[model samples]
Target: MRADLDIEGGVVVGIDGSDASLHALFLASEEAGRRDCLLHVVRAWTLRTAPRPPEVPPSTVPSVAEFHDWIVLRTRALVEETLPAPEDRARVRLHLPRSQAVGALLTAAETAELLVVGHRGRGSRLMLGSVAAICVRRAGCPVLVTRPHHRRAAGRRATAGG
Candidate 1:
């Protein structure tokens, strides 16, 4: 753990601007509140499209910055609004990055006491989203895959193997 980063009793959660992820955020916050730990919420984004030669090859991609900014803003608001009054914003930290969501989350989870994520955010239960599955399999800490409203979406095939 970085000396500047505080991970003692920290709970890291991934927020992907989806209801399921938001639920994960809420659950993480509640857990943190109970343990009096800090909650770290990270939202990740990637460039929608890479610049082509004819497109003047912009010096930098603005969309990346904008997406990260949006995630930070929205995650901060959701965290603040969902938590109880006693849970102060000072105890919550939001991170926005322009990398893969699962990788960013796993990195954050390295020093965290616990990691919380949704089972299938915006994806079918038959197939956990790549990010969620990756975190569950690779996170340094135990992962709680929350599914407060998980239901079998229509047309999802049943699998024989677990």
Candidate 2:
């Protein structure tokens, strides 16, 4: 499987507005920078397929293109805040998909050398916060689960002293 992964080319990462996703973005960007590879940022969004209520106006319906563009802008700003100014912004490719996250992310993973995500995510499930778990288990590529920096630092201190 490792042989198939284009580690030399780059990796793909999924991000949303959630804190977990931001953390994943940070990690993915750093790895990409270090490896001199491209960072593909993919965001998944769902649009309502059912018709709206009678009271709702046709104009109220949001354009999928607008939403996708908005997400891309917001994601770019977030990434810029976290990472050093890119020598070439073209290195980062933002993909917005109008579909379910799990499937979209899994598809993205196929081309990724690695997948990075946080330990939790924003959504309800039997596990409450288990997006990372699902991705790690389902993604075709390797996944990195990031923990809060302070927690990891504290753990290191405790281990060092004891």
Q: lDDT of each prediction vs. the true structure?
A: 0.68, 0.65
Model 2 scores a TM of: 0.71
Q: For model 2, how does the per-residue alpha-carbon lDDT over 65-84 read when each residue is reduced to its tens digit?
A: 65566666676786776555
Q: Show model 2 residue runs off by greater than 4 Å.
A: 1-9, 48-59, 88-90, 123-128, 153-162
Instruction: Tell me the tens digit of each residue's lDDT in model 1 across 15-106.
Output: 77677787787778778888888888776665642122233346854555465555566666777665645545668877666676766777
Where model 1 places Cα greater than 4 Å from the true spot, the runs are 1-9, 49-63, 84-88, 123-127, 150-162
TM-score of every model versus the real structure = 0.71, 0.71
